[model samples]
Target: MTPPLAVDIDGTLTDSNRALDPRVLDPIREWPEPVVVATGKALPYPVGLCEFLGIPVRVIAENGGAVYLADDDELEFHGDREAAQRVVEEYRELGHEVGYGKVDFTNRWRETELAVNLDQPLEPLKELAAAHGMHVFDTGYAYHVTSPGVDKGEGLRAVCDRLGVGIEEFAVVGDSENDAAAFELAGTAVAVANADETAKAAADHVTEGSYGDGFLEALDSLRDA
Candidate 1:
């Protein structure tokens, strides 16, 4: 039997320009095993994507801060939002906005972590998060400030426990630093050609194709395995 799939969005499922590649829709929708959309994006995006794709709404969002399982209609939050918020507030005091404008919808509905625009300076932000007992992970799209002990691997473990599956029984695909943890836990970890060094180092396989094409390649390999 095919293992359940946990996939990232952004650089993994999108084109170079970060637009969702329409080609990935059918395969993911038709996947026989459980498909979990794990992303550094906020909860709503993945949940809405699953709804649109006609799949169960299983997601690990905010890097690992929030998890939702459709079977029990359960939404669990594991990160310390107040700690993250404090870090963001300090960042703001340092004369840097979260990079999104006043009406920043990017973080409007986010419950556990803070997403900072890539344009903002990263080093200081990382320092600020660390000072607050949080960590910053760059997903190639944004800088996510999350509480300690929360990451994609831990999120996948949580999902697996709830699904009655082992963490080693999943196939994970991703392209950035935020994905490295999940890659370490998955039985088969695939990194797309566009993956960063961290992700590639943790993956068992690296696809030649980039973006959505890489994702498709990984999917085909899983189906054949």
Candidate 2:
């Protein structure tokens, strides 16, 4: 049996603008290689894709900071809650503005992390963080403020640790900066053809197509391997 292959849903699997090829998901469900959708998108995106693809189960949401097993309706969240709360409280203490969504949905510490929704741009956020002795991390959508160091890379590492799978056994696929870590973690890092240049550069290989077709490309790569 093949180890789990962690895949990204949005640009790597299906283009929200276009429908996914149901044929692709068939291999994932029937083949020995089990697939896990690792996406930076929120719960809704992964859930919808899973439903549309008839994948009833699969997906690591919020860039692997949270994992949801649709088949079991169970969630395993990552992140240090106490640490995140301390950071949030610190932000409050410092009077820095912050914005977040889906926070109260789960009280678990490991599932939630400190995310700074940027009202402006990263340069300003970096300047502010540097002035405050805080670290600013990039995640494509936001300039994340963290205690010292934390991001999707660490989150992907955690998932691999829990699953007891090594990089040699799995393929990590994604289409954004957050996906960078998983790219390094898994043996083969697959980036969608539509992925930004930065992402493509970091990837071990670029998919032949976009979204749905890109997934097929990665699947082909898997078969070739």
Candidate 3:
């Protein structure tokens, strides 16, 4: 059997305009194995995608700060919500916009991270996290302030266990720094053509196409592997 597949959403499976390319949906419907939508977006977005594809899949949301199993409608969180809320307050006081009102509807449901779209340098955010006993990560779209222990890698590991598969049986695809740890854990680490330098450096393979096209290519290769 082909191993379970894990993929990032934004900048990997979605187009530059943040729209899901319809081309990728049918292939997902026919996939013989479990597909995990590993993303930083909230649960509802990915759940809606799975529904549109007419397939059952797992979700690792909040940048691995939380995991949601579609079958069970269960949620497993890894970060401290109180600390995350405090980080949001700190960022707002520092004159940076933070929270759902500033970003989107998903921000209101976020439990473990505060995502900000300040478009500022990340170093200062990292410094702020240090003071709050937290960690900061960039997902190519926004700055995420989260608990130091929460990440996509941890989420992937949890998903692997739930699926009763090992990391070596998995092929992971992503396009940013938050995906680095997951890349390290997968048997085949693939980066899309437009992936960040760090993510490309960590991958075993880099697809020629970008976004959904790249993900389709990677999934085809994994199915044949």
Which has the greatest TM-score? Answer: 1
* Steric clashes per prediction: 0, 5, 0
Cα lDDT tens digits, model 2, 1-225, are 345677766566567464555766777676565567676555566666767666655667655566766445667765454554555555655556455545633222334454566564456555555555556555545554544434455555655565556656777777777677677767778888877776787789997788777877777777777
Q: Give TM per candidate.
A: 0.98, 0.67, 0.92
lDDT of 1 by residue, 89-134 (tens): 9998999889889899899999999899999999989999889888
Candidate 3 per-residue lDDT, tens place, 6-68, comes to: 888888988988787788878777878788888888767777787777888588888898887
For candidate 2, the lDDT comes to: 0.63
Report clash pairs, candidate 2: 77-110, 77-111, 78-110, 78-111, 79-110
How many backbone collisions does model 3 have? 0
lDDT to native, each model: 0.93, 0.63, 0.82
Kindly report which residue stretches of model 2 are placed more than 4 angstroms away from their true locations once superposed.
Answer: 1-3, 16-24, 43-48, 51-58, 68-75, 80-119, 129-149
Better of 2 and 3 by TM-score: 3
